[model samples]
Target chain A: MNRNRSVFLLSALVFGFAFLYVPIISMIVFSFNESKLVTVWGGFSVKWYGELFHNRRMLEAAWLSVRIAAVSATCAVIIGTMAGFALARFGHFRTRTLFSGMVTAPLVMPEVITGLSLLLLFVALAPLPFIPDTRGFSTITIAHITLTMSYVAVIVQSRLSSMDDSLEEAALDLGARPWKVFMVITLPIIAPAMISGWLLAFTLSLDDLVIASFTAGPSTNTLPMMIFSTVRRGITPEINALATIMVGIVTIFVITAGVLMARQERRRQLETRGAGR
Target chain B: MANPSYVTLGQRILAGLDKALTTVMASPPYRWSQGILRRAGVTGRTLVIAVPWVWLLIFFLIPFIIVFKISFAETRWLGSPPYAPIWEWVEGHALHVKITFANYLFLLSDSLYVQAFLSSLKVASVSTILCLLLGYPMAYGIARADPSWRNTLLLLVILPFWTSFLLRVYAWMGLLNNHGVINQFLMWTGIIDEPIVMLQTDFAMYIGIVYSYLPFMILPLYSNLEKHDPTLLEAAVDLGCRPFRAFLSITLPLSKPGIIAGSMLVFIPAVGEFVIPRLLGGTDSLMIGRVLWDEYFLNRNWPVASAVAIALLLLLVIPIVIFQRYQLQEASGEQQR
Candidate 1:
């Protein structure tokens, strides 16, 4: 029985990993193909990478996407943290249900609906003072913030809820003001979750296509928008090169984060052991 | 006393202002205002709640209302907004409100809209089930793996999710197209005489969705399974149950919450997925998301598009409500435990 179980697990892992990775690996490999046709493997070459770098439109879209993601992620973290703290600390307020519902609704809300509704909103608000008349960078950023803040809120809320409250209460007992207590005690404890939330928001903003498409003006195309339009025209080696580069960057980041977290866990375990001793 | 003579004019002014501010702070009126601020929780809690609350109300909730209202308006070709206003001020003091149910009636009477909605639901449901079938064993494997390897395994699962979603879908196009890698490989292996058509089919669509969303299913399942008590399985085994029986009797029952949560996560977004069906599915794969997109962008009928969105939301309202209630119950249950 044990042998059979082990065999089953081994096959499951092998097949699952392969299924997840083979297409990505193939794409990366084909990115280096010298042939114009992606499926045909000629000798490996770096021409596509060179071509990608010279593509002014693609580069501009990438730069714009990164900028939008950074600003949106920062704003999302601020608003999301506040929403999270309220949901975590202020229990059973008058509009608690409504608050939670609004916060989490976007997590499962379809991108199409969110995109269309927000587009309608922007169009409606155009006549009002202080609202931008054209959908562009600001509009895309706002749409992204609405989409990503919910994720950040959920992350921070879960972290805050799981945390022990006595630490905050103890700081308060020592005569620290509420704000000081939160900054000195609560913030430091939940800082990791906050950072992860920010990263998540950043990646989500960068990855979005549908919502960005609706909110972006003709001149404010994002990277995904560029890539989508290009791919729809037909398969291109430049896209493969772009995809490979993206995969490389994401893999590096994920590995670094994973290693850092593992190291932190080890240190924490060692410190706890020392304290017990 | 010696420093008083050396004090600059700026320092003297600053000292006077500081003293005056202190005196004002010590006054009864100032103290009363401070007390009121504290009672209102303005320092942290209220600010925290109000800031996000106001933002969501303005940007999130109000948009839904606008969409709902627009659904009742008439589409127009010769307008700046492209939709006739639902309410207009008439001559003198009279108010005129023009609301039409034509959009909703059209959606119902039109076979195209009906088919799109049903097809979207069918595709989403099938993809969700496929994700669960493939994800369960993988999640189980990860959960039961050595602790040192578990984190690495989970990272591998999420790594692909961090890459560009469009790129990943595009990658499938390269592999699944007629002259793509999969067909080429099959031809090379002598498994078939000719390359089979795989891209732009329902089969390709299913593959795209299951591949994209399998991580969503696995992560939740892994978290739930990792927390499962092994001793319960042992107890079941010792009670004359086979291994499969033990799993069916104990493990499956305990992971019901994860199953429901994961299914909902995969199903909800898949129903309204635009990119996958547009990129992978054939011309006949008229999902509601694509329909809505075409109506707005291609046909430039904002009112009909808004009505479609409203109809979709209404269809999803029950699931969203149920999911929220489940989340609330789970949170409370966790607190109790």
Candidate 2:
């Protein structure tokens, strides 16, 4: 029985891993392929990555995407932190249920609806005041921020709920002003959660194709939108190169963050032990 | 002695000011309306928590109002722009401020829209079921694995997400195309004579959806299943129940929340999925998302598109309500526990 179970598990792992990794491996290998055909293997070359660099449209889109993600993620982090704080700290409020629902609405709400609604909103509200044209960078940033904020709020709120409240109270009792107490105590304590939320929001903004497609104008074509349009035309090696680069960047960041977090935790443990002694 | 008195007097003055501020900040009307956040002082904490409220109200809430507006509007002749209501400039003329339901009428009257909506529901429901079945077994296997190997297995489950979603979906296009890997493998192995019509089929779409959404199902199931008490199963065995029977009665019931959550996570997105269906599914696939896309982008009928979107929202309302209620019930349960 034990042997059979082991065999089953081994097969399952192999199958699962193959399904997960094979396509990615294929794409990565094909990016370096010297031949034009995607499947057929030839001598390896870095021609595709070189080709990717020469593409000005792609480069511009990538720059725009980075700017959008940075702005949106930053705004999302701020908004999400506030919303999370409200949810976690003010749980007894009468409208807590309503607020909570609103916070989570964007997370699971269909992206198409979000896109359509925002598009309509922008068009409708354009005539009202100093809002100006809602078809450019500002609108895209606003949409990204709104969508990304829900994610941040959920992550931060979960962290806050898990943490003990007495720490905040202790800081307050120590004669620190409320602002000083929050900055010194709450912010530092929840900083990791906040950072993770920001990372998540950044990733989401970077990956967003649907909403960006709806909200973006001619000038604000994001990287994913550019890639999508290119792919719609036909398969190209440049996209493969781009995808490979993205995978590399994300892997590096995640690994580095994981190591840093582990080190920080160890340092905290050591400091606490030393203080106890 | 003078310095001590000065310090005491300054401290007293600060305390008095602080109390006065708190009272005003925490006053009933303000507190009742927005809660005790005002009392929390305009610190980073307060700002951090309150800022999203303004953002959500402006960006999130305001957009829905626009959608609601378009849902009632008449379509333009070119279908390029949504209609604004007509008003007479003369005081004696009758005002026609009333909204039209024509856009909604167009949706309800069309068989294509209904078919698409139904197809989306069917696909999402089936894919969700499949994910639960495949995911739960794998989750159980991982949870029961030796502790040392658990993380590795979990990593394997998560490995797919590291790749780009579009790339992953595009990879399916390559694999499911007529002259593709699976067909070639099957033919070379003498399993089939000719290429199977895999691409542009419901089968291919199902495979794509399941493959894409499987990780979501596995993660939740693994978390819930890992928390199962081994002794409960042991006790059931002690009471002379079969292992399978014990699993059915105790384990399955306990993991209901995870199953439901995983299903919702998979099903909700699957319903709104525009990419996979467009890529893999046949022309007859008829998913509402693709229809909505067509209406908005290709047709440029914003009113009709908004109407379609609103209908989709109404369809999702039930699942969303259930999911929200479950979450609330779970939260209060945790509090009680």
Alpha-carbon RMSD to native, per candidate: 6.9, 7.1
Write down the lDDT of every candidate, Cα atoms only. Answer: 0.89, 0.78
What tier of docking accuracy does candidate 1 attain?
acceptable
Kindly list the per-residue Cα lDDT of model 1 for residues B1-337, writing each as its tens digit. Answer: 1234444443465456656766886899988987998887665467779899998998899999999999999988888789999999988967889999999999999999999999999999999999998898899999999997998899999999888888899999999988899999899999988889999999999999999999999988998899999999888778888888888888899998888888888998998999999899998898999999899889989999999999999888887887777677766665554
Cα shift from native, residue A175, model 2 (Å): 3.4
lDDT of 1 by residue, A1-277 (tens): 7577777987888898898898899999999999999899999999999999999999999999999999999999999998988888787998989999999999999999999999989998899999878788999999999999998888888888877688898988889877667655677667678888998999999989999988887678999999989999879999999999999998888888788767766766776676678
Give me the candidate number with maximum lDDT.
Answer: 1
TM-score of 1: 0.93
Lowest lDDT sum, 10 consecutive residues, model 1 chain A, at A180-189
Top model by DockQ, which number?
1
**DockQ of all models, two decimals each:** 0.49, 0.38
In candidate 1 the C-alpha lDDT for residue A62 amounts to: 96
Where does candidate 2 clash, by residue pair?
A82-B48, A82-B49
DockQ agreement of candidate 2 with the native complex:
0.38
Q: Considering summed lDDT, which 10 consecutive residues are worst modelled in model 2 chain A?
A: A1-10
